[model samples]
Target: MKFGEISESEYNEFEKNHPLGIFLQTVNQYHVLNERNWDAKLVALRNDNNQIIAAAVLGSRKLHIGRLYEVTGGPVMNYNDQAVVKTFADEMAKFCRQHGGLILRWIPNLHQAKFDDHGNVLETMNQAAKNNLELAEFQYNEPQKVENGHYSKVALSYEFIKRLNGLNAATLEKSYSKDAQYSVKKAKEFGVTIRKIPYAELEEFHKYTTATAERRGFKDKPLDYYQKSFKAFKDDDKFLFAELDLKQYVILQENEVKTLADRRQQLVEKSEQHLSKHRAAQARELEDQIQHHKKRIVRANKLITRFGQKPVLAGSMFSVQPQEITYLFSFMNDEFRDFFGPYLIQDYMMKLAVERHIPQYNFYGVAGDFSGQDGVLRFKQSFIGNTYEVLGTYTRVVKPITYRFVRLLKRIIGH
Candidate 1:
């Protein structure tokens, strides 16, 4: 096999069709990182017939010492092949060394295990691929760090994914948890509409995401990152927003209030005439419903006064790849939590996936805490998906002396 740099078109063509292909391994992501001042290159290993067998987008950034090189999301290839793994690792190490890299970091898009929503191991997958990488001199970083709430900014070590095979829009809702179904129904009833927004509207998406990041104690990327991503990915990227029509919601609530009041009035009259406990109870329930609708109407009116007739309740960004549709980032207006806009967004995207014949729906990252206590895991579980634990980040030191010296310096300087 010959190892060398490949053109963007060649890398993209192979990546889009590879079984392990992910958006992170694509040319689009390379450009996204390259524009941010990272030295990004598309490298591939070609077989005797000159067919690309293994490919990766290597990104390097200058550090305090030498350079930190990364192969995020891939080097997409048949990981089960020991020869390919060894060759790729050797070539990557050589490439990194020549480029003055201290360490070469790689996060393969290979799953180590599959689990149920509650973290119960259902199956062990791709163990050979992991062994091959380890045998090739890549040191596996313990996944426990990510499971313990320390997440990597480069890539996710754990993910929540839903299989969409043999499922359509009509059958998809049946797969959701009862609560998720109820939320979707309620969001629809409240006139929450989901639609794809253009690149010009990313600021609106970023606004909510930034607010959510602050509220949830996480960092968010700048608006330019999203803009560049949209430009690079183009049609493959979707920026969806869930908006509530305040006027329609208010009208619906007002009508419901009147309807409930009329029912309560009739029940009251019947109770007076029959003097029955059942009729009295029915009237009480009707009265409660009427009051609830009235409160909803009042709240809707207040929202309209503040945010106008239509307001965005939630926003999410998704990536459409050949293998799956990924739910990458999302945010919601906390005040509109009752509207369940996030649920609606998920349902909409899942149906879109079904329509497009996408095989999987990736609910990107989760702290591998499947104890039902992790909020991210719990929320994703509602969509009825399995947990996938991938072999976490791996590091190969290209320049050991420099790496050790840098580490020592950093430790001494309290960096």
Candidate 2:
């Protein structure tokens, strides 16, 4: 087998069809990181026929001591093959050492275990993959307990994924929880429409995403980061906005109010003519519905006054790849929570996944806390998917002396 840097085109071709391909391991990601001043390379190992079998997009930046090399989300290859795994590890170590790398870190896109929504382990997997990497001299970095709980710097260890294999539209819709189905229906009933937006509209997406990040206490990337990503990924990236037309919603509400009032009038007339208690009760129920619709109209008008006639209630970004469709970043206006726009966005993306024949829809990055206290997990659970705990980060020290020196210096400095 031959190991060395390969052209972007060559790497992309191999990665596009690989079973383990992910957007993070693509040339587009390399370009995205390269633009940020990271040294990025597309490296591949090929068999005697010069057919590429294993590949990785390695990115490195100079740390205080030496270069910190990382391969986020992969080196797209079969980890079960020990020969390929060992050879790839050896080559990567040599390459990192030659490039003055202190530590080489990677988070393979391989599942460690599968858990149900309630965090019950349904199946244990990837032990052999871990063992193979260990034999290849890569030290597994087990998830560490931090103040916030289990955390890993390599990548998100837990993900909620819906497997779409052999699922038709009927079965796919059946997979969702009742709440999810109701939310999607409510979104449509509220006149919430979802559409794919262009890169020029990313500023709008950034605005709501930033607000949501602030409200949720998580850091958000700058506008330029998303812009750069969009530029690089182009057609493979989807920026979706779920919008509501306030004028239309208000009109609908007004119509409903009138219809309810007309029905209430009929019931009241009937109650007066027959002195029927049931008719009186029905009239009262209709009156309550009329009042609710009137309130909705007033709220819609207020929203219209604040935002424009049409306002985006939710926005989400997705990474489309052959292997899966990943729901990446998303945010929604809390004030418009009743619109259920985010639910519609998820439904739209999942439908796209099914249409494209993608095998999985990944609702990426949950806190791995399934105690029903985690809001993110709860939201993802509504989609009826399993929790996947991936084998976390692994490291192979390319320069042990420099690594040790850097660790000692950091300790001395209380870093």
Candidate 3:
């Protein structure tokens, strides 16, 4: 188990053959970020059998009020040996310390990752606990955690696949929640097609997604970010996409087939009543209203059917160590909200998971308690995936002076 830091390309080769196939393990992330935050990237490599066996992306010089060195996602590794991990751990500090005069800071990818067993997280936690350190507690806008800290969230991945054939509207309701299930039903019946949007069109996907995030009041990365992110790891298809037939949007309560049916009846009755009532606006309004009601029931049915633009569902997912797969962002049209297009897209993604027997479908990060987030949390929880508490950041001190100086500076600057 010889050890030494290596270059990004050298590391990527090791990553390809390692048991953990992860995009974050690539050197490209550090390289690209270096363009913007140049000082924040470092690479470490080690080999076995004269082949690159372990490599790490050591991001450094984190700008904070106090001393900060930020390392994330992780070191590329084949962590089968305790001696290897221990050696890498020590080298990690030395590698990061080389970049700055401040405290040597590190948070392994495993530490940042939340999972079902929490095995890796705990392992890293125990390792960190070995250091002379003060544990962190969560607070508001001000970070209760600091640089050199680690955190993670555990939730069911949208990548989950339960069963496709027997997947009735009820099953969808059971998996996602009543509203989500209903939306899927609505999408199908309204002539909204459910199909995969290809990776080639990912640019378009980002555009709509950015617009959606803005309208929804959240931050979104620039298209270049996605482009670079994809380029950095496209070799493995870690970043994947699927689009909804905007025409096929739906929304309903989980296990609410009857409710959707009832809504459909109401829409039909309303349309019939307004049929002889002629006015372009009125006719269009009624047509829209009817479609809205019908979309839920229709999409509920589509929940069981599969249509995607990707060559295969498995291709849409990428990972290291077969860990969790989380959704970064998703999109759909408001004009077709009545058709439940987004829900349809989600169900299709899940069906792909079920068919391919993928393990998890991470909903990414969800706020624990925010008034506006009720719907989002509900949607995530509806999937029957285990929800673990999101960990707050915990920091370690490498340089006392720099740490305090940064903190005081932030206070002076009012950060």
The prediction achieving the highest TM-score against the true structure is: 2
Tens-place lDDT digits, model 2, residues 1-415 = 8899999999999999999999999999999999878999999999999999899999999987789899888889999999999999899989999988888998899999999877889999989999998998889887754334334545787899999998877777778999998999889898899999998899989998999888877678799889999999998999999999899999899999888888877776766567477777887788889889899988889988898899888899999999999999999888888999999999998998999899999999888887788887888899988999888899999898888888898899999
Q: What lDDT does the true structure give each of the candidates?
A: 0.89, 0.89, 0.48
Tens-place lDDT per residue, model 1, 173-251, is: 9999999999999998888999899978999889889988888777888999999999999988999999988998888
Clashing pairs in 2: none
Candidate ranking (TM-score, best to worst): 2, 1, 3
Q: Could you tell which candidate, 1 or 2, scores higher by TM-score? A: 2
lDDT of 3 by residue, 1-415 (tens): 5556566567666655554444455566665676555464445544556665556665554454323455444445534455555565555555545555455433333322232321222212333432311322111122232112111221211121122334553354566667676766765654445543445766776767777677766656677776665665454334444334322333333224455456546655777555453544554665565565566546545543543211111112232223334455666555345545556556666665455444555555444332434555556555555334322233345556776787798889898
Total clashes for model 3 = 55
- Candidate 2's C-alpha runs over 4 A off are 144-152, 269-272
- Cα lDDT of candidate 1 equals 0.89
Say which prediction, candidate 2 or candidate 3, comes out ahead on lDDT.
Answer: 2
Regions of model 1 farther than 4 Å from truth = 143-150, 265-275, 411-415
RMSD of each: 2.1, 1.7, 10.6
Indicate the worst ten consecutive residues by lDDT in candidate 1.
141-150
Which residue pairs come into collision in candidate 1? none
